[model samples]
Target chain A: MSPKGKTRIRRFSPVQRLFHVLLMLSFLTQGATGLSRMYIETSWGKGLASVFGGYESCLTIHKYVGIFMICWFLIHGLYLFFKIDWRQFPRSLFGPDSLLPRFEDLGQAIQHVAWMLGIDRLLRLDRWGFLKKLDDFLLRITRLPPLNRVSYLKEFDGLLSVITKPPRFDRWGYWEKFDYWAVFWGIPLLGVTGLIMAFPLFSTRFIPGWGLNVVFWVHRIESILAMCHVFIIHFFIAHLRRHSFPMDRAMFEGSVDLAAARHEKPAWIARLEQTGKLESQLVAEATPGLRALFYIFGYAAIAVGAFLLIGGLVNSPSITW
Target chain B: MKEAVTRVRLVYIGGAVGLLIGLAVILTVPVRLARGQEEVTSKIYRYRERVATGYYEGYEVSPRRARAILETPGIKRGLFPYGSSSAMVRIRARLPDSHKGLKFYYRNTCIECHPEQARNIHSVRAGITCRQCHGPEPIPAINHYYSAMNTIRRHSYVCAKCHEGATAAFASFYVHEPPAASLETRESFPALFYTYWGMLLLLVGTLAFFIPHSVMVGLRELSEHLSFSVPHTLMVGLRDVFKKLVFFMSHSFLAGFRKFSQKLSFFKPQNFLAGYRKLFKKKEAFKNETDNAP
Candidate 1:
């Protein structure tokens, strides 16, 4: 059959999707091998380690995969460099497209919380001059000096404005920014520490002997923390959210339903409309085979991640104690 | 075509870089293997006692308890005596009657049995006794059986026993025995010490924020999607308390309070009562209708 009509908006490019897959696979492998060594004394840990031939084999796999990931991380950095428009410069860095945190994100976070609790509805007023009323009330109460004809009260007004309407998502949400930065920070820290452990002789030459101990401790703790965040938080936001229950196939298929995208990322949609690029961004719907593959892969990943997470937690000192 | 060319260029560049790195890593194979062998050879005999101590500490069992476990029939006979080849041959030759006791007493001077250790650096330079350095009691014969399996590297806490001032001043973390070199003044390895604190802060700060944020967001999403409602009484009480607090803040209490209440219609007690009653009234009405019909 011919491809379906254009009802999907492109989200992730092919390269990004590829990176996501590789990263996911490597991360899972690392979690499995790393956690196995961590909880080696426990019977389940021993069992898991045995699957990879033993503790020694687990360490070897963890090391080699880690090295591969480090290389991949560098490649990713290079990919990003080549992708950026140097002519755009600061706009490419500081614009909405970038994942960097901004002042508005704080307000958005509060607005999100308010939205979640139904307080947004309570705060919203449909009458004219609501902004004026809010400004007057704030000025009367705080008695603070105005800020550039639009004080922090304007922020309150913005909050009310944002809350009154449906919460508009940009290209990246706060959660997505967090997830991106976590990996960005985590990869270098983990890679360096892991390399130190991998080549002790070289590392010890530069670092004091006890620095190795500290490195090992940080590596383990950070890994556990990462596992907890990804399996619980990342999984929830990406696939388990109410709107995206079962799975979000955007990353898998490189596009999202136009209607869903419009609802979820109104700001992005509006920008696209303004630029008249929405039509070009639209793609034919994913084939059934592709959808099936994604579902199978997504569910499998979730299962593996959950298993590793639970296994690690169960054998952790806190729970075991 | 331009995008394709850029992609091709990226692929070539990435491939060339990857090949170089791969080759570099491959070149290190021999060196790493040689280094590995050297490490094993060096550590095997010199720090056998410390390694054995680490192995014992891994069990987290008391010496008395370990003795009891080892004393069980068929187990003690199966246990090996020493970790190192030198220790096995020499210890067996020197301490023929030593295996008689199950209790490990550190009082035994290790140098007497293994006098070769007297020439060791700590002994000759520092005038440190084998008993003081390696504990007064060596590990008992029963526990020595598992010393061969002491693969986990352990830093010696034995150093801290004598270096009390350094331990007290610099060795704050009790995760393992502080490495002897680490117990210097802050000026020594200041960077590593600071990095250690920074790592700790990062770990704590990330977990502290992310875990709670995740949990709260998860719960909120779940609750909102699942349509979980707060208890009616609790909700009402909270609304009342909040209104009262706001009333105290208002310049004119009665008028402001009236306006505020008027503005937020949901704050009206009648609305709350009506909703609360509606929720229960259906169940009550159904029960009454059934009862009356019967």
Candidate 2:
């Protein structure tokens, strides 16, 4: 067979792409509804509330949207569990060689900050170097690392080595791990507080007279934190980063251009190239059942959207000055 | 793979059907569960009875009927007399003495039971007796003592007729200005009860925010034991708790502002006033110098 010299950028499976689209829409709706409620006294708040019907209707939609968000979180978690290769999964989490920051990563971060401030030129540390050095140093000093590392660190120097080495599918990158933990912690804090606010009866059972007030406080503070995190960290990494400006398609298209991947995730590119066997393995790993599940969820989401739209229309309050 | 596709299609159809049904049910269920006509009438009658009893107990009276009367289109204008005189009082005074006969006659004569109250009535204006407000004929079926007690209870309406203002009835009756000893005896009991209830709601709501979840659950359960007849008391407690939680959460953001202010007294009123005064003096001085200059 003739060697195909062109680098083939693998696209996201149809299911994964659909899931990403739905997830983004759900988050956007939630953010709009939540922000509207938070600033209910303002003109923007009134306009947003009117879009949902009225103040009370906006609140009702906010509650249901919250429930929807939680369900999405659960589905996403299950997808990670069922579809993602378990061997590849843990490496993303503990793989210091990827994007998981170490002590040296802090220096790189500081250097980048300085470059932004025009104090110094941007540093060109290797993709895995700073993070890998930090992970190794932390693991050596701590003795006890993550559960994934406890089993694999004996054979491998650290998660960095495993991720950077050949023969493993590089589809799941280090950035995915950072995003995972960020969401994992953020969702629970917001979810529990949100549930309390939404379900007053349930909250009152435990919270006493001040249950609503307490829920309100926690909900508002957590919301502010989540918004700040999304605006600063998530925005910076996803769009505002030097090379990723305009957009990064890896999150939505679930694929990166070879040149961009080489520049941003060089270790991942090197590992994939060294292991000629990795491509076939990844292709084989894609299951029809996973695609089927995505279709099911997509239909479910459409049904939910239609129901909400109908309910909103029928019960919409008459607006008066 | 084909089988999976078929399964997905089935699930999708099922989800759509289920959602439609759910939406239909949610929209209609509240209307269906609403009380029927007979039930609604009985409930309204019961509520009226409760309000009548509450009036005798000296609880704050609702002006629902009066409000309804006021809201009726053209009614207020129609009721208003062409002359500038107070129509309400004139109409009441002009009613025939024969029509003043009480529907529910009282057995107890006011003079027999509340001799002091009778004396006070005479002292204010001779011939102006309890019967003026309580009606001429007393209830022959009920106890005379109960009738006299009812008269004293209903006297609050007379007081309210003159002294009405925003929460002024409760405030004046309970927390009297230039305090009246005669009024004090009658007012203090209701005042104490109202104060206790208001504080209880506020305190319970506040406490619910800090305590463990189980403790809140216990408080909710405990509310059932607190009330005698109505489940409303428990609901009120729960509602207050929810309000408190919301208040606590919302005000938490203000804690940042509080901390900031504590660390540095930015825009303190005293400091602001001082700066304003200094600026005013400087401006005055400049104006004086300019005036003196050629």
Candidate 3:
């Protein structure tokens, strides 16, 4: 098979793909049912609510889906715990493959913003030195060694290699790290507040009389922020980006085009090839039928997300003004 | 492999149908309330029983009725021409001579039995006299008192009558009592008060930073991807978005119709029996094959 046709990079494991599907399903369900109740006064919200059998049913579905999400959230944590070779210990957490943010991610984020703003073009300055100093300072505070990017590029492919080489992010981008942690931060807050609100009488036994009010506010604000972030920012980064327009199949089929991987994740690709693990990572490309299924699921999720965001904004008080 | 894919698709269809049926069943189910207080207390009304605790055996309406009436609005202003607070003056003004022309008279007979309750804070504040809450006629309360007290212990039952919007803020909590007197006051629940403020700040701070960051990123992408001066590029981008929306809507509509038709076909007796037999028969055949292999 031609190298271009070969799916030689496994971007996601089958387990990870399964988790993604579950997350997508639960998140979309939660968003749809949640926004329906939140904006029930609006026509769109009302219509959506009636589809789910009115306000009471929306509440029921939201609660049940929320419980499901929290369960999966805990399960995901356990999955990660079990997957780790304890021998790798702290390395599993701090290593290049880790989702945890590192000093280099800050440099990458800065570089990205600089590139986006055209600041990088105006200055041929050794911006790396400045970033390295910042990274050193961060290291001093965080007490973690800087991650070294091991490149295995046998033959550099001109401009693609040059641009991707500068900020050689390993496995995960800084934004991707932010995306992962945002869920970590959000789920617990939403879950705790949701549970408190779910079982208020029990909660009130320990919480003060006014504790329910506080819990209510936290849940509302956090959920709204979450919906906006996921529907707009996360959606744009994951699917609507130039490279991944239409969809990012990596999370679905568990691989990306080796050529595309080389261009976008040069460091990760190079390391895999250098370690001679590249062949092991290879898998057959998804069949057309499977691809069709993925497209249906992906687009449905995107539509629901868009509906929630647009429907919410339509009735927002600020928009009326 | 093709058959496996078909089976997967069938499973998806069956799952969705099952979900819809489940939802229908749940929505149609009647709300079953807890047994009424009268039933719990064995048919004898609590107040009607000869009980003394340094207070009159106050006979208000049933718990359910009081709750329903409390939920009712504008009753205070409409019912009490002379403010509910000054029940004494209003009752005296309607004394003997004035009673002849009045449509309804204050039943001062209640205070005769329940004098101490008349001095209670809620009654005094709302100017609620006996008939105001107990009703001008006792017949309705007596009839329905045994039916149910479903609304009394409901979260925000009393407060929701007036504070409808605030009640919804914590509707999921399913609380059984009125809000605490302290509310958000720091003096009573300092920890909660601070946590609330902390959460508010976190929410505001995160959105403040991230929203602008997202906007900047969006703008940068637009600038990088499309040259706005070229009208063709803009047109192409918009056309792509429109095409996507059209494709999605039409595809979903068709898929829905297909599923509906499949469901309708499933109702056919032959198809139903065929499916049932095929499922179990295949399992049985597999069992025999395994037994023969061993």
TM-score per candidate: 0.56, 0.37, 0.55
Compute the interface RMSD for candidate 3: 13.2
Task: Please tell me which model should have the higher lDDT, number 1 or number 2.
Answer: 1
TM-score, cand. 1:
0.56
Each prediction's Cα lDDT score?
0.64, 0.46, 0.62
Candidate 3 regions with alpha-carbon error over 4 angstroms? A1-4, A124-166, A318-321, B1-197, B215-294
> lDDT-based ranking, best first?
1, 3, 2
User: What would the DockQ be for model 1?
Assistant: 0.07
- The C-alpha stretches of model 1 lying farther than 4 A from their native spots are A1-4, A124-166, A318-321, B1-204, B211-294
- Choose 2 or 3, whichever is better by TM-score: 3
The weakest ten consecutive residues by lDDT in model 3 chain A span: A148-157
Question: How far out, in Å, is residue A320 in model 1?
Answer: 11
lDDT of 3 by residue, B23-55 (tens): 999999885341111111233334543422221
Candidate 1 per-residue C-alpha lDDT over B49-119 given as tens digits, one digit per residue, 9 for 90 to 100:
43334433323311111110112222223345445764544353234244444345345546555654464
TM-score of 2: 0.37
